[model samples]
Target: MKRYLPLAALLVSACATEPAQDLYAIETAPIPAAVETAPMVGKGDKADDPAVWVNLANPAASLVLGTNKDAGLYVYNLAGEELQFLDVGRVNNVDLRGDLAVASNDETNSVSWFTIDSTTNTVSHIGDTPTNKDEPYGICAGLVGNTYYAMPTYKDGVAQVWAVATDAISDGPELLAEIQVGQYGQLQLEGCVFDEANGQVFVGEEEHGVWKLDLNDWTAAPVSVDTIDARNGLVADVEGMDIWAGENGEGYLVVSSQAADRFVVYDLKAPHAPRGVFTVVESLDGAIDAVTHTDGLDVNSAPLPGFPNGIVVVQDDGNPESGVDQNFKLVDWTLIQAALGLE
Candidate 1:
């Protein structure tokens, strides 16, 4: 049976500790954007989040899965070519693992799913899961042992973490945990990613900050991963979050400092420890322009072509090259590491 628990009330019942009051705001840096894909198919604010699927057998031939939101998912090669498009109908905030890609669809008020054939690199729509949330927004995929989880958050802050048995065989998302979170500023929130390494999930609370909540402990209160304070370097509309975890619990929590037009990095071991913030600037080669007004982003430590170490992609809301619609920008993660002295 599925369970729905209100986090605000659970905090009182469970006797959870208060989130840390002290936050670190360090210096910021600039990480240059290498290349950006062509703008999204339509006009204002179309290109959204990105998910990188590495070809385990052929890392160099990896694919970048992005959401058009207005239409469906777009499969692009490393070079930013449109290999395929699935008109799944307004599936926003996409994510994938192995052969499956899942998203939050406010259009259908459900969670949509898609599959990709690794050999042929083609995509097929499987369908969407039943949703009870009023307006589905940010969505992410996670795993515990071998079981899959589909976590979709409502624009009003209701988050449903579903244990998905609906892969190649099933279609329903069995509710594992349904909880509430904070939604500030215009009843909005976007971008969520799971940290399978530490068994934690991070949710971006647009106006407030990022929150770190344990996956198994339903009663525990959500801790503040980081917050936006203009006195510090961070600005409002804190968007797009991703985790880059390597072996032995060594990694970083990256958040898009949208209002300030930069991305901030934090130590995963000590999540609140501010490492440095960075902006994806224009390429010196004039190949791409700076990244601004980023919404959702993705990062992976697995080595792939061009990016010998890893890669990260951010939604570039800017129209570089004088384009009309927004597109995603691919950056070398190592460059960001080196720029922020994370190496």
Candidate 2:
């Protein structure tokens, strides 16, 4: 079920120039995926991000939602079977909470909403509402009490907090506030997650690192929790991130170090200390290939199928085995915890 290869074997060729000590990634053995989604429409970097929806009544029936940036959103079963496809073009990133699913609709320059029918285990297109930003880049949504809040980022490092009404999915969300995450027009900010428990949102500045904004105070400046430092094992282009929730507000924040083909973990709580780093490699049977050049990822701590402690779904830009298009891969969070010796 797992394969242990030499750390040197996994070192990417791009890192040949940098001194080995500069890379603080734990270099744990690669973990294989439990399942993988069907390839995207047509080849060449189509799949971008994924969202996991747990079926409380039947955890085995939980679903995975992903975005095919060129085509639309895909609904897949735990087994990686394509259940449904919503043809909303150029959806960059997606996140779901409660019954509402929100994605960054790049084609329309707005945020497209969808409804998750738990009764039927299906997702349907709700509608989209315009955004003030010219390029509606990445997004994440979560419930802060009874209200659903969505944080959508733009290429220019500007992000907005919106309150989406479940009763009116088509009408879009109410813009609560807009904050400049970094120097305007100088930052490429995307892939954000709402830490509702902390009343803050963590945004990734692709080339720089991760920054946090306290939702309670929109006027305050963004805080740098981590930077593109070798000590933290962050290469350029930190793509996607999601929190691995634990009981009593204890958990870890997982981030994608895209250019390096690895993911870094940090304490979900502030000070946000770096925990470990890992990457998905080929399965023992060579069915599913290693994931590289990842764009976005999502994590859930709720138990599901082989992922007893929950699952992590990541965008695999190169589906080497299928030799078709990009797709998402599902890995058990327990495997990651065990690999990194996390509590």
Candidate 3:
């Protein structure tokens, strides 16, 4: 499936606008000291992103799939126990479609498929797409009728969107559309989430900010909703994004400010603008670098009653000196709920 390429690649210049320095460091109520950490499959391996699968039949057995950038993909049980590993080599982003979990491997610039065994909390390799010249980063799964959409990060400044048969794992992914987003700073494409209800996709350029694209009409130019320069108290390097569906079935978009170790939650109701909800600090060691470079996030309604409806999980690009302990964090949504007070 990876046959076509754009005629030319162009990089978008960094926006000249700048916001004032962030004076407020995130301060919040103490997190649960008893919170358990997810077990690691190997020491020194950087775990970058995660996608969660809730097992309705066995609620307590839900699985959390994570990427080990230098290794592959690892599956863990709800209790944070590493259950299995699928070695695809340097996977950076992961998403799910039915029982299959798809991952983008940066090293090989390809996407690999894996089948999830919920009953046993395991992952088995299915197949992979043809390789590309651009390193693949963030991914989002969208379904249009029977076709599944696999969106890859920009290579040479163009993001390619592919359409694949949901059940045909071994067959290569067919290219459906290609969108060229000029490069911005060191930011390549890193985060993406589909607004299925609206048939739109949000792509994040690390340094430039986020762009909204319509799936139905690929020829229409993308609309830029927000940029790093507009966000206060955070760095320009934005990485991961997740949409939180509210009680009314509407939602908000939560994005990571990688360099500042914080998050900017945007209200999707009205003009679809950003409102700084709250900042998440590195609670483990209270070091700035500990939580810096936050990437990949997933939100799931808490199964337990009275707890906030959702929980936000983030990856910690740990300080280089803290060898053998790279990790991801599970942030309680209750505090964020209190801060936003959204009904």
Best model per TM-score: 2
Model 3 CA RMSD to the hidden true structure, in angstroms: 8.4
Superposed Cα deviation of residue 242, candidate 2 (Å): 0.2
Could you tell me how far off, in angstroms, the CA of residue 106 lies in candidate 1 after the best superposition?
1.1
Model 2 misses residue 13 by how many Å? 14
Question: Taking the tens digit of each residue's C-alpha lDDT, what string does model 2 give over 1-343?
Answer: 2223357755753367764443434454478877889888575668889999988888888899999888899999999999999998899899999768899998998989888888899898878878867878899897865678888898878888889566655565799898889652358888899888877789998878899988778888999989886457776788899999887778999999887778989998888998888888877688888888788999999988788888999998787743258899898999899988878
Off by over 4 Å in 3: 1-36, 39-45, 232-234, 247-249, 281-290, 302-308, 319-324
lDDT of 3 by residue, 76-113 (tens): 66555677778789888888766777788777778777
Q: Could you give candidate 1's per-residue lDDT for residues 1-343 as a string of tens digits?
A: 1112346655664664664322223455667787677668555667888999888887767889899878888888889888888887787798876677888887888888887777887778888887876668888888766668888887677678888654333746687777767745654567788888787888877778778778778567777767675334455677788888788868988888776667878888753587877778888787788887788899988988889778999998867632257888899999888877885
Question: Predictions ranked by TM-score, top down?
Answer: 2, 1, 3
User: What are the clashing pairs of model 2?
Assistant: none
Candidate lDDT scores, in order, read 0.77, 0.84, 0.67
Clashing pairs in 1: none
How many clashing pairs does model 2 include? 0
Q: Judge candidate 1 at residue 78 and give its lDDT.
A: 89
TM-score of 2: 0.90
lDDT of 1: 0.77
- For all predicted structures, in order, the TM-scores are 0.87, 0.90, 0.82
